[model samples]
Target: MNASEGLWSHLTGGALFWLTLTLVVYTIVDRLSLLARRNPLANPVLHSVWVIGTILVVSGTPYETYFDGAYFIHFLLGPATVALALPLYENRRVVLRSLVPIVAALAVGSAATIGSVIVCAAIFDLPAMITISSLPKSATSGVAMGISQSVGGDASLTAIIVVATGIAGAVMATPLLNFLRITDRRARGFALGLAAHGVGTARAFQVHPLTGTFAGVGMSLNGLLTAVLVPLAASLIGG
Candidate 1:
C-alpha cells in the first residue's frame, strides 16, 4: 500500500484514533459554538453528531468498530452524570427553597411528556412497541432505555428517540423561552431540563451556573419520576 493508505489503515485500526477523533470533533464544534456566541442553534452535541456521523459514513467505518475505540468516553457518562450532584449541592439553598415548585413542575411536566407521546402514538396508530419506546424519550438515554425495556419497548429505539428529543429541545428552548418573555433563569432551566434531559442541562450551563444547577435538578428528578411512571403508563396504553 502507498504510505498515505498505510497510515490511514494503521490509524483506523487502533482505539486511540477513534477516541481522539471524537474528542477533536467535539472540541472543534464546541469552539465554533462559542464563536457563534453560544447561539442555541449552534448546539455542539447536535453539530458534533452530524460531523462524526458524516465522517463514519464517508470512511465506511462500522459503528461497532468506532464504538470499540470510543467506549472509554461512553464509560465516562456515568461519572459525568453523577458529577451533576456537585452543582446541585453547591446550590442547595436555592434548590431547597424551590422544592415545592420543582416538585410541582416535575409532576406536571413528566405527565404531559408521556401523555402527549401516548396520545400522538394512538392518533397515528403507531405500533405498540414504538409507542412504548417513545414513552421515555424525554428522559436521559440510559434511564430512558431501561424504562423502555421494562415496559416491553425497544431499548435501542428509545435511545435514538431520547437523543432526538434532547436535540430538538435544546435547539428550541432559548428561542421559545425568549418568545414567551420568561426571564426567570430557574424556570427556563427547569423547563429545558424537564423536556430535553442532559442536552438541555448542558445548554443551561452555557447560559449560567444557576441555570445549569436547576436544569440538572430538573433532569435528575424527571428521570426518577419517569422510571416509576413509564411502566404504569405503558400498562394503561397496552404496551
Candidate 2:
C-alpha cells in the first residue's frame, strides 16, 4: 500500500501530472460533447483547450514545464494524423467516385475561407499582420500556424482564430447541412473536415463511421492543399 501510494505520487506529482490531467479533462469534455450530440459549441477540443489553458494561466504554470508531460500527447498527434490513412485507404472507392466534388469543394472551400477573412478584415481595417494571420483560420492548427509564420502574421492569434473558426464551423455546419438536405455521409464528412478541421472531423466520427473516414480524408487533403496555396495567395495579395 505504501509503495503504491509512493508510485502514484511520483507520477502525479511529476511529469505525468499535466498529461494525465489533460487526458482526464478531455475525456470528460468528450463525453459531454457526445451527450450534446456533438454540437460545435460544445466541441471537446475547443472546450479542452479553453479549460486547460485557463487552468495553466490561473495556476501560473509555465508552459514549458507543463509541456514536459503534455509533449507525450502532442507527439501522438503525428501518429494519429498518419492513422487517418487507414480510413482514407478503406474508403478509396468512395473517394474515387466522388473525386470531382471533392476537388471542387477543396478549391472553393479553401478560397472562400481565405477570401472571406481577408475581405472582412479589410472592411474593418484590421492590421495587415492580423488579416494575414486570420487567413488560415479555417485550416487545422498545425497548418494554420505554419501559414501564419510564412506570411509574417501572428501565430498565436492564428491559433486562437483557428480554434474559434473550428468551433463555429463544427456547431453551425450540422444545421446548415440538414437544411440543405445533404444527407450523403461522404459529402457531410468532407464538408465538415474541410471547413472545421479536426474538431469537425471529431464531430463527424460521432455521427457515423463512414462520415468519420471521409472527414479524415478531407482534413488531411485540405491541410496539404492549404499549406501550398495560402503562401502563394498571400504573396500575390501582398499579405
Candidate 3:
C-alpha cells in the first residue's frame, strides 16, 4: 500500500481516532452554532450526528468500532446525568414554590406523551412491541431502554426512538414556543424536558439557566414516571 493509505488505515483502526473524531466534530459544530447566534437549525447535536454519520458511512466504519473508541464518553453519561441534580439543588427554593404546578404538569405531560405515541401506533396498526417500545420515548435512553425491555419491547429500538425524539424536540422547541408566544422560561424548559429528554434539556440550557434547571427537573421526574407508567400501561393493554 502507499504511505498515505497505510497511515490512514493505521489511524482509523485505533480507538483514539474515533474518540478524537467525535470530540472534534462536536466542537466544530458547537462553534458554528455559536457563530450563527445559536440558531435552532445550527444545533450542535444534530449537526454532529449528521457529520459523524456521514464520515462513518463514507469510510465504511462499523458503529461498534466507533463506539469502542468512544466508550469512555458513554461511561461518563451516568455521572453527567447525575450532575444535572446540582442545578436543581441550587434552585431548590424556586422549584419548591412551583411544586404543585410541576407535579400537575408532570402527570398530564407524561400521560399525553405516552398516550399519543400508543394511539398513533395503534392507528398505524403497528405491532404491539413497537407501541410498547415507543411508550417510553420521552424518557432518557437508559431508563427508556429498561422500560422497553421490561415491557417486552425492543430495547435497541426504544433507544433509537428516544434519541430521535430528543433531537426533534431540541431542534423545534424554541420555534414552537415562540410561535405559541410562551414567554415563561420555566414552562418552556419543563415542556422541552418532558417531551425531549437530555437533548431537550441541553437546548434549554443554551437558552437560559432557569430554563435548563426546570428542564432537568422535568426530564428526571419523567424518567421515573415512565418507568412505572410503561409497565402499568403494558399490563393494562395486555401486552
Candidate 4:
C-alpha cells in the first residue's frame, strides 16, 4: 500500500502538474496571440492542446495515468455547461419569442450540415469510418465522440474532426453571416453555435451578452439533437 501510494505520487507529481502549468502557458500565449492581432478562431485551447499534447507524447506518459489526476479538471465541464443556462434564463423572454425560428433554424442547419458532410465524404471516397466520424463534427467533442463510437467510428478521429470543424466555424461564422446578410444577433448567435459548437459559443459571447446566451442554447440543443440524429443518419446511409 505504501509503495503504491509512492508510485502514484511520483508519476502524478510532475506529469499531472502539466494541467496546471499548461494554464499559465495558455494565458501568456493567448495574450501574445491577441496582441499580435491573431484570430480568436485560433483559440488558446487549440494551441495549448498542441503544445501539451506534444509534451505528453515526448514524455511517453500513458493517457490513463495522466487522466487519473486530470479528471477533476474535466469534471468542471458539466457545471460550466449548466451555468450557461443562467444566461439563457435571464434572456427567457426573447428566447420564448424566438423559439419557433430557433427550432426551424436548428433543423434546417442540422440537416444541411449533416447532408453536406456525408455527400462530400462520398464524393471524396473517404472511408466509411471517416465519414461516420465526420458526421457529428459540429457537435461538442464528448457528444460527437460518443455518436461516432456508437456507429463504429473512431472516437479519436471524431474529436480531431470536431475540433477542426469548430475552429473553422468560429473563424468564419461572422464573415459568413455578414456575407449572407444575417444581421439579427439572435440568428448570428444561433448559427454560430449550431455550426461551431464550443468555439462558436465563445465567439458569440464576444459579440454581445444576448448573442452569447443564444449561442449557448444553440450549442447545447444541437449537441442533444445531433447525438440522436447522427446515428440514425449513418444507419440510413449504410442501409
lDDT of 3 by residue, 10-80 (tens): 98888999999999999999999999988888888889988999999999988889888988776775677
Write one digit per residue (lDDT tens) for candidate 4, span 1-239: 69987885576556457566566778886887677565665576677777777866876767765565557665665677777788888999999999999999989988888999988998999988899989999887777888899998899899889888877887788778889998899999988888988878887886788888889888888998898889889998888
Candidate 1 error regions (>4 Å): 1-3
Candidate 2 vs 4: which has more TM-score: 2
Per-residue lDDT over 36-126 for candidate 2, one digit per residue giving the tens place of the 0 to 100 score: 8766678787789889889888867778777789888867756777888888888899899999989998888878877887789879999
| lDDT for each residue of candidate 1 in 53-77, tens digit (9 for 90 to 100) | 8999999888888888888987776
Candidate scoring better on lDDT of 3 and 4? 3
Assess candidate 3 and give its lDDT: 0.91
TM-scores of the candidates are 0.94, 0.86, 0.94, 0.85
Residue pairs with backbone overlap in model 3: none
- Please, what is the whole-model Cα lDDT of each candidate in the order they appear? 0.90, 0.83, 0.91, 0.82
Candidate 2 error regions (>4 Å): 1-14, 37-40
